[model samples]
Target: MAVQPVWHFNRSALAAIALSTLQSGLAQAITLMAPRQMGKSEFLQYDLLPHAEEHGWRVRYFGCATVSPRALTRRLQEALSDFAAGEKWLMRQFARLAGQHAATARAAFPERLVQELAQLRNEKKPSLLVIDDVDRVLQLAGGDTLLREILRAFAGTNGQARLVLSSTLTGHHQGLPALLQQQTTVLTLPDIGDAFVHHLVGQYHQLTRTKREDDNPFGKLSPYQGITWGQVDEGIMQDAFNRLQRIPYYFRALVEDLVLNPERAPAEALQVQLARLQRHRVAVLSWEEMSRLDRLLLTEVAKGTRQFYGDTLRQYLAAQTGAARVSTSQVQSSLKKLMRNRVLGQEADGRYLIIDPHLAAALSVTDKA
Candidate 1:
């Protein structure tokens, strides 16, 4: 099937890379690690979900950011409901089969879903399971101990059942995917190459229907244009693509928004959008309203200590700030607050540091960068 090749940058290629994995019966798991706006989740919803259905598999999708690991059991039941949609043919057949054995229908699919040996023999089609935003849930729920429990029940059934799981982080955490990594096929997401980004700009331009502009984003996307045609030199294209790679999504958005406004320079628009994102990331932190105890914790973190663990690190905050030493539970609560604020990074070793060096310099939110 032809891909729509959305201008989200690297998504169609990523989809191509992912869909190709289905050719192998061996489970090929992947994590797309490109920039935030590269449309990793969109690729799954658009490309993988429907395409996997062609193999006669019923795809089950749940997101960790949308639902916690502790909620996996209930959420899986809900996905079964979506699978058993009123208009669905498979569900119709399930219901028809149920009429003959009314007692077992409700529990049967789920029971068989957990154990593939029985399902493989009696099932009419294949099945796929998807869990998205696993990293967020792992961060929130303390790893995917609960989520892995559900997945472990379905292990070693790749031929009859396959799974597609997504998380934002690249490395293993105390997360669901990490626990299951030994059995999974891991794929890392690649960023957009300098060679074809003009193609990305062109794709978005077609979506916009704008022909020309002042300091145009689309027309002068040098890297894409350079390798693309005789219109621009390769050196100039490479130079431009290199300098602006950090903000391709910003460029796309600028082009799209400015297409109608013609008066805007795409570069200036890009600056505006990136600044807006940083501000938004920062503003989301304000809702926390850090208590005096919380501020004390932050004050300790600015001092920098390796032995200072997550909540333990925060303990130094209150004690050193001349405030009450935060209670064990309060310190734990403060740790979560800092993590959610994106102002601190917690290593697998249990140490919490500022997000990254560059972001530390940005002095806004602590990004994993």
Candidate 2:
């Protein structure tokens, strides 16, 4: 069987470089922030992790969406214990000092796990903990504090370990901005461009042999016969560039949609699919998915109150909901939910804004009426 091709992007190269250049004693973390479905996780998993392992680093990857912080901490403890056991001298030393089994050492709490990993350092080799979809992790109760503790532990470890946090640019997680500001190096993924689109489209055509041919009745070539970039129509490629907005995931979706429905005209099919997506977005979650207070909070956000101080938002929600007053905690809970849903995003200046333009536009139309 032939080896499958992996789509390489400029951002993937940059991420690998960033990981390779991390100084051990710097007490720094790297943040890869991008929009959802933009391949941040895939880049970290398929590209960055392999690169780190090849350079002799022990990598522990946690998908934060599926794993809670407490569970992740326990896993880290076990990994550290196993790492220590692999080194006979260190295991013996630990055994002599504690007079306990390795499993007992593995039972350390999250805080102590960090300390242990931090202290287990070799100049030639280091450990890496990659937390993907960190925004979801922050959604869990006490997640921000847990993450801060983990990062702090690594920072104090004298170059023993490093952390890579992958998250979307949207959402407001308490203390995350401060944690990022303190010592993390931030990397943003740029939009995909025409050159990448051309390469990708050409690759798809060649792989699927979808070019028009005179010999076949349907005017499609055999799968074994590859197509060149020039053979693909420039107009269709341009339409793809415009329609997909240089997002690789969107492009792939469009291509898959076209492949699955070969009888439909490519451009028409793409437009139809995009329209369906817009309709789904409009219908999926509106007033039904949110509480009255949540809708009021979002309405206020949509009305151009770019920043919502806790008290201000609480007051607005209370007034809109016809309650005498609202508590700050209630307002905060609603805001976090909105942020998590990607309906609202926090700016660098700590102001909240609606990040999804389509949803914002739909809401604005409804408000105007």
Best by lDDT: 2
lDDT of all predictions = 0.51, 0.63
Tens-place lDDT per residue, model 2, 152-254, is: 7767766667778877654223324666656577777666567666666665665455344433676555543442334335568667656554456666767
Which stretches of candidate 2 lie above 4 Å from their native place? 1-12, 23-27, 68-111, 171-176, 210-235, 276-342, 345-351, 355-369
Give the per-residue lDDT of model 1 (tens digit) for 1-369: 235444534345555456567546555344433334455566677667666666456666666566655675555544543443412536645665567544554455545445433344346666666676655545544345644544554454445555666655421233224554564566655555664556645654564443433326645653222122222334443444444444455545555555444455444555676665554433235424657665555445544455444666556566666765656676677778778877565766676654422233333233223
TM-score of 2: 0.65
Mark the 10 consecutive residues where model 1 has the least summed lDDT: 222-231
Off by over 4 Å in 1: 1-13, 19-25, 28-35, 50-73, 80-112, 115-126, 136-146, 156-158, 170-177, 180-183, 204-248, 280-337, 340-342, 353-369
Model 1 steric clash pairs: 29-185, 30-187, 57-126, 198-224, 296-317
